[model samples]
Target: MTVIHNLGFPRIGKQRELKRAVEAYWAGELPQGALLQTGKELRSRHWALQKAAGLDLIPVGDFAWYDQILEWTCLLGAVPARFEHAATADVDLDTLFRMARGRAPQGKPAAACEMTKWFDTNYHYIVPEIQPNQSFRLARTALLEQIAEAVEAGYNVKPVIPGPLTWLWLAKGEAYTQGATDAAKLDLLPALLPVYQDVLARIQALGIEWVQIDEPILAVDLPAVWRDAFKGVYSSLQQGSLKVLLATYFDGLRDNVSVLNGLPVEGVHIDAVRAPEQIAAVRAQLSAEQVLSVGIINGRNIWRTDLDKVAQLLKPLKAELGDKLWIAPSCSLLHVPVDVEGEEGLDAELFSWLSFATQKLDELQWLRALVDNKVDATVEAALEAQRKALKTRAESPRTHNPTVAEKVGKLTTLQRDRAPFSERIAAQQARLNLPAFPTTTIGSFPQTQDIRKLRRDWRSGALSDTAYEKEIRAEIERVIRFQEDIDLDVLVHGEAERNDMVEYFGELLGGFAFTQNGWVQSYGSRCVKPPIIFGDVLRVMPMTVAWSQYAQSLTTRPVKGMLTGPVTMLQWSFVRDDQSRADTCRQLALALRDEVHDLEAAGVKIIQIDEPAIREGLPLRKADWDAYLQWAVDCFRISTSNIENDTQIHTHMCYSEFNDIIEAIAAMDADVITIETSRSNMELLEAFENFHYPNDIGPGVYDIHSPNIPDQAWMVELMRKAAKRLPAERLWVNPDCGLKTRGWPETTEALKTMVAAAKELRQA
Candidate 1:
């Protein structure tokens, strides 16, 4: 019989129990014990779900309350000096967050671990700090406990751990890591290997069959030295009693396939979801003794698998490997949401077309059964539902708008900008009548649980539509008051109306399909179920104007209407593979163009359309960068073209590494651009310096992601550095992104210091 395995399960519970528990623990409403209890309950629930779905190998050690990478850091004891002391005791969740976000609990000045987006995904992870002279010791006790927990719960679990190569690959630079390269950090691994060996020995003693070692770095371009290191590391690891299944996901292992051929590891898992062409090559290349786990299910998407197509794709591989071929998700099920069955508010037709985590497992299980000739009529029925969903999506009126397509095709480069920056600035100043050295937040305030619950309740019909609108409006009013109190120059409605920057737009636009539970992990425990763009996208209604106008009604400060830009919305969504991304992006731009004009007509003086993901979505290879950037830049221009020159188009980017595409960033031609720079100490602005960005700019003065209150003096020093690099009149003072991740007290204190710092700069 073919084995069914999961690389990892989603840690956040079906109802987002982990998020609620974590927030409650932080709020002091729940204790640490309660948080741990919630984790246990979630883990048990996940195990039960996977078992009921008939998985042969349910994974342990992959569940993390925070992040798997951080767990790897803790396991190896490669923590920076700051977190080392904290981990000396049992790793507390609060201490972990403190280390990750940089909160100083004991009066020590907080230095947060650097955070960056995880591989083109919106999720953020804590970058492990490894000094050049760093040493690692095996400290994988936490992982051991998880294994014990699973065994104690009566499940024979496959323990999951990040492979050595991926662990080092995911780490930040030593100057960033406080100074360590893998070569300099090599001594630490010698100490680290024993703990992993011991853990394997312990599992073997407990009669555990297999352990999954994930080395996803194999998909990326690697140095020859690293390949040699992989050979040496696995050779040493082969001493362990438990069999190793080295799993590689996300992309194809092209050149690196031979590196695994001679390795002592028992089995290897490949991601067939992304690179299906590699299966034959991998099968041909692997030694005859090796067992191949084919990842046939689409873990990252909501579209139902055509079982016949998957069965056909796998038949040849199955013919070669027979029962040796294990069927698994392309990567981890953590990327998918738990259940589509619970989504009552979604379009019934669209819902039928989708599969969440539960559905996906069933799909894989049934596919294996089909191959084994054990599938029932239920399998046939499910396949039909998928076919119907695809058909409905393709033929539905929701998928097209002739007017929107025509508008996109007609757009010129001139639409990218109404006028040059110098003229636009003068025009904008005249229209808005705002003070100098403007201060405004990106968009969102904290997404408190009550707000989430209210939205959920309203969606489920537990709360009346009127009640939901009243609650959201009340939140907007509160935010407007707060901004006024801070004396901000430009204001935002706090984005309480939006569940996500991109999802909000997708919900308003035509030709978008939402899945009942199509979730993909952004990073750690946070997941985003992005709405799918199946066809041409267009805006039929004003999405943000009503909220912006309402917020404006409460303030004299010029409120900036916010929207996720065309390129960002396209990049973030699961776009149709058939359409040229440029064509689709242009369609979205045309849709947003209507909204820009609508906001302008509503008397909103400034419109800040955020395109944070634009630079991130760039192709990894430098060879293909320009083509992607050109269309991306043009899309932004087309979207904002309908607005008048004096309307003052502003854009905000968060967690951006804006080095390579400085010219493309310049080409977006927004009058003002706010970028996240606080954590990097204005270092991210080097691209702007090199390119000589002529637009008014805001490089965030303080890291808003952290709850630590930055002193006014700290912001003043950052502004002082920024002033040297940027002309003063062209500089705007703002927090890095939104204050959504922060509590109100911290947000208020940080902004107060930020405002004071700006005031001091003005005096200077």
Candidate 2:
């Protein structure tokens, strides 16, 4: 019989119970014991769900209180020296959260460890910090406890860990000397392998037969040295009694298959969803005894599996491999929501075309059954229904727009602004009349508990529309008055009427579906429910003009008409897969262009179109980047460039390395751009300096992602460093990103300090 399995499940509960529990613990409402108990309950529920879904091998150690990477950081005894005190049993959660998110507890502050994107995904992981001569020990209590808890519940479990090679490859440190030659951080792999060996030995003693070691870095191009290092590491690891299943995903292994074939592992898992051509090549290299886990369902998208098509693809493989074949998802289900059955009020037709994490598990099970020739009547009905939905989706008029297609085909270079950067800047300055070192926020204000409650009540019909509008307007008025009092140069309306930057606009646009429980984690305790774009995207009416005009009515200062950029809206949402991404992005750009024209007509002088996900959407390999950036940059320019010179355009990007793409960013040609830099201590400013970037720039003065506030003097110092790189007159001062996730008290004080710093620099 073919085995059915899943790589991982969503750790956030069906109703986001984990988010609430984690927030309560941080707020001191819930004790540590309560938090731990909630974790155990979630883990137990998930494991049982997987088993009841008929998974042959249930995965353990994928559940995390914060992030799986941070768990491994602690397990390897690589806790940074600053967090060493909290690594004990009593305050482990404190240490873990501090590493994931910097914290200030009892008037003492700890800067957070660095965080970055997880290999082209929106999920963020804590970057491991290592010294030149890093040593490791087996800190295996957490993994062992979770595995034991699952085993006691009477389920066959396979423990999972980030492979030793990938872990060291992802780690950060200065160069070190090994023997007579100098080597990078990955050279410490020799020291890291013994710890893995010890952990595997202990796991084997627990009666666990197989372990899944994930080496996702193999999907990228590897240096010859690192490829050779994989041999020594796996050779040492496979010496134990445990069987190792080497897993790779997100892309095909390509030429790395040769190195993989030489490894001494019992099984290999490849993502056939992303790179299906790899299937035949990998099967040719595998020995008859090696197990082949084929990923047929997409782990990154929300579409229902075309079961008939998948069966056709897998039938040939099953005939050749028999019981040695394992059916699974292309990657972990962590990228998707928990279930679609819990969502209500969706269009019946559209709902039939969708699937979430739970439904995907069932798809895997049914696919395995079909391959084994065990499909019963119920399974057959499901397969038939799925085929019908796919057929309907392909033919539906809802998925295409003739008018939008014609407009996209007619696009030309004439859509770009006629004026040069210098002329536009002068025109903007003449109209706006701002300060030398102006101060502004990126976009939003804090979405406090009361504001959230009011929105929820209004949505539920408990609050009248008239009353909700009055409340929202009062909040906006309060924000405008506060900015006036602070004497900031530029202002924002606080965005109290919106939910998420992308979802708010998505709800108002055509060709979108909203969900009630489709939450996916962006970072620790931060989850985003991305909207699904199912068809032709068009702007039916103005989305942000009313708010922008109302905000401008209260202040003489330039209040930016904030909007999420087209590329970002497309990148962040679950976009349609049938059409080309460029075509979909063009449709979104045309929709945004209408909104931009509306905002300009409303007398909003400054408009910000945030494209934070542009860097996130870049291809994993450098060779494939040009084509993506060309269309992406074109989409952004198409949305913002047709405005008047005095109507200044600003864009914001956060948490990405801009050095390599500085020229591409320059091509967007917005009047002003703000980016996240305070976390890197203004190191990103070097790119702007090197490029002699012509447009006005805002290197963020404070890190909004952290709770700890910066003093006025510190802000002044950071501003001085920025001034040294570029002319002070060309600089804008702002926080790294939006203030949506921050508390009101901190937001107030931080802006106050930021304004004061701007004044200090002006005097200096």
Please report, in order, the local distance difference test score of every candidate based on alpha carbons.
0.78, 0.86
Candidate 1, residue 515: the lDDT equals 62
User: What 10-residue stretch in candidate 1 is worst by lDDT?
Assistant: 173-182
User: What is the overall TM-score of model 1 with all chains considered together?
Assistant: 0.91
- lDDT for position 493 in model 1: 90
Model 1 ranges off by over 4 Å: 83-90, 103-109, 173-203, 376-378, 384-398, 411-414, 429-436, 447-478, 513-529, 553-556, 574-582, 620-624
Q: For residues 163-262, what per-residue lDDT tens digits would candidate 2 score against the true structure?
A: 9877776676434211111247665777888888888888888889889999998887777777777777888897467999899998888877887766
**Each prediction's TM-score against the native?**
0.91, 0.96
Predicted structure with the largest TM-score when compared to the true one: 2
Model 1, range 1-764, lDDT digits (tens) per residue?
Answer: 78888888778877777877876766578887888899888888999899999999889986776678787776676656764464455544555666666653332436666777755555566777665556666554767777788888889799898887677666755343321233544545676667667657777776688989998877766666666677778887875467899999878887877787678888899999888989887777667777899988877666677787788877777777887789998988776678888787676776776777888888887888767767679877776766777678667776667887677657753445567788889988887776556788888888887888988899889999899999999999998898888887788898887788888889888888776555666654456778788778878789998999999999878888998998888877877755687889988888888898899899998899899888767754355688998889888888887677789888998887887688889888888999988877788888888789999998898887677777888888988888888888899999998777777878888887888788888889
